[model samples]
Target: MSSPFSNTVYVWQALFLREALDRFFGSRAAWAWLLVEPAMHIGFIGGVWGMMRRNSMGGINIQLWIIVGMLAFFLFRRTAVQTLHALDCNKAFFAFRQVRPFDVALVRASVEAFSMFFISLFILGAAAMMGLDVLPDDSLKVLLALSGLWLFGLGYGLVTSVCMRMVPDSGHIFQILMMPLYLISGTIMPLRYIPLPYRDWLLWNPLAHGLELVRLGFFSNYHTLTVSFSYLYYWALGSIALGLALYRGLETRLVTQ
Candidate 1:
């Protein structure tokens, strides 16, 4: 007999790919929005901020920094937000015998996250061509940062999926949390610039840790970002555990609904 793990892997991969393609083509307009919306938001925000603080926002050029920060941030935020409603949105797919609620959420979140990752790379490449200081100084750390962000999103996505299923009102709770996360995560400004009390406060936000690591990876020339490998590892583990537990408890009920 074939290895059970291999068999399961094949099934999951096939389903994942199929769902991803379906999602991509099902909403071509939305996919286009993903690219254009981020570009416009980054450009508009970066331009506005860069113009006002041309004097003291680090000589590294505000627009490019914002591009890096926003792109990295949008990936996690969008994925987490999407996950909150993934189950409710794909109720039809869950009606099918073969597709589990968890699978629908996982597949959708993965596809969107993966697409944003590639889009981020394309943005970086274009930035490089335009003489933007977007290249990573330590490529390995950059990979680590990306891996951490993806894991954080996946783990959190799973948790959010289950939470929303259990408590329908969680959709609004997620929105409340998401609004403050952008500021705390150091997406618009460097952590070093923050005051001591607030800096310590911000460090507790896992996204901040990930973003700091990414910033250090990219701009090794200036700024200091110290992230503990253990911190990221623990957050990843906790998010996955909580997510799996919640999903297991509510999977059956969610499937029926």
Candidate 2:
């Protein structure tokens, strides 16, 4: 019934981010590691694919295409990954009299989201300096799309954070399955090039649609693929509902564990 950004939520979010930022800044190495890890992932995985396609690939340079794709996907992945253990990660905060379980999860998710959002800009800037074209063809649309993806991350984070409490192995299962998504979702390769069978199957992943929409801004000539925003919205909505319900239902049990 109340707005999400009402005074209570706003104040809580502000406090959570402030504390988490202090925690994050205290370890400069971890902050730096975010940039380093993404570069390594892009360099090794994206770079090898670029080399293989250099001779025959058509349209945009694969490296540039992938840099942006990785930028978007990495943000999503980092938020989702950290969200899995959101409660456990902030158990110390939970012990505080003022901190509720949802507060702990919200704070952790918001901090990770804020960190990754900046990292994307840093990555884009670094890409530009290194001779890659990271500028969007249409900045406004790209901004809107980025906003959508960011919201999706927040919702997914909330959902995953709660779900992991009920099912401890969800995080490990997600890690194992996430790699194949990169390959099949057209992060490293263009969808047109993927065979019909695989491409059809990938249609089921709403995140794939979001990624492709983001990709369309990078490659102007490619007609954007149709995506189900409603499908993504369903996950976003479902995640929030399920997460809040489970948390409210089982906070005592999880915190005790």
Candidate 3:
């Protein structure tokens, strides 16, 4: 059902993905450390939160709440960071005419997406084994919300990648900005915990809505009346369009650099 050109693209994509993974993991021991890091992070956060609040937040299991939020946030952050630096990071591969900067970014995004999928499964499975409720009440909704998060990150990455390519130093500024965005996006705290006027302002962030939708899918009783799927989609689509437009305009400079 696929044309030769599409199949050739697939082959290049796979090769790039493998190269990215190799560069990321570096060794078998690094892979083991990667698995341990998330577990420790989740444990520390969950343990601290569990001590402070004995009951579930909004009737969702505390561990599940943290894990879901963390995974969604992590996926976006990881994908964006990877895509943002894809060009400069893999510039050596550009020696091949088939390996465009866009291809590098695409391969980096694909690698992060695939890595997150497996990492999420491991976290959820580990939580389930620990007797936490790791199952989603609405699987389809969760899938959509998570997919939106990834797509949004991919789009945002495209824009940022172009920006970074144009101005290499901007990458550092973007990394610094991501910290506050991560906290405000409700990675460690639920929106319900925030007081009135502040909650209204945080809701303006599209990622906050995506995180809320993720929670909505995971917990039957959990509900966020403020989340707007349309708003999130608008930003996601807008970013992708703008990024593509910018990339096309600067493709010549990007390829030369």
Query: Which is the leading candidate under TM-score?
Result: 3
Runs in model 2 deviating more than 4 A are 1-19, 26-28, 53-58
Lowest-scoring 10 consecutive residues by lDDT in candidate 3? Answer: 15-24
User: How would you encode candidate 1's per-residue C-alpha lDDT over 31-96 as one tens digit per residue?
Assistant: 677788788877887777867866334446666677777887887777777767777877876666
Q: Write the number of the candidate with greater lDDT, choosing between 1 and 3.
A: 3
For all candidates in order, the CA lDDT equals 0.75, 0.69, 0.82
Kindly list the per-residue Cα lDDT of model 2 for residues 109-213, writing each as its tens digit.
Answer: 677667877878887788789887777787765665555666666667676666677788886776776688667766776666667787777778766776776
By TM-score, highest first, what's the ranking? 3, 1, 2
Q: Name the lDDT value of residue 13 in candidate 1.
A: 83
Model 3 over residues 1-257: C-alpha lDDT tens digits? 99968966975667665765684578867666656766787788889997897557677777887889888888888888888987777767667676666777767777777878888999899888988878888999889888888888888889998989889899999888888988899888877789989999999899999988999988879955579778888888898788788877988788788
Clashes of 2: 0
What's model 1's overall lDDT? 0.75
Tell me the deviation in Å of residue 247 in model 1: 1.6
Which 10 residues in a row give candidate 1 its minimum summed lDDT? 53-62
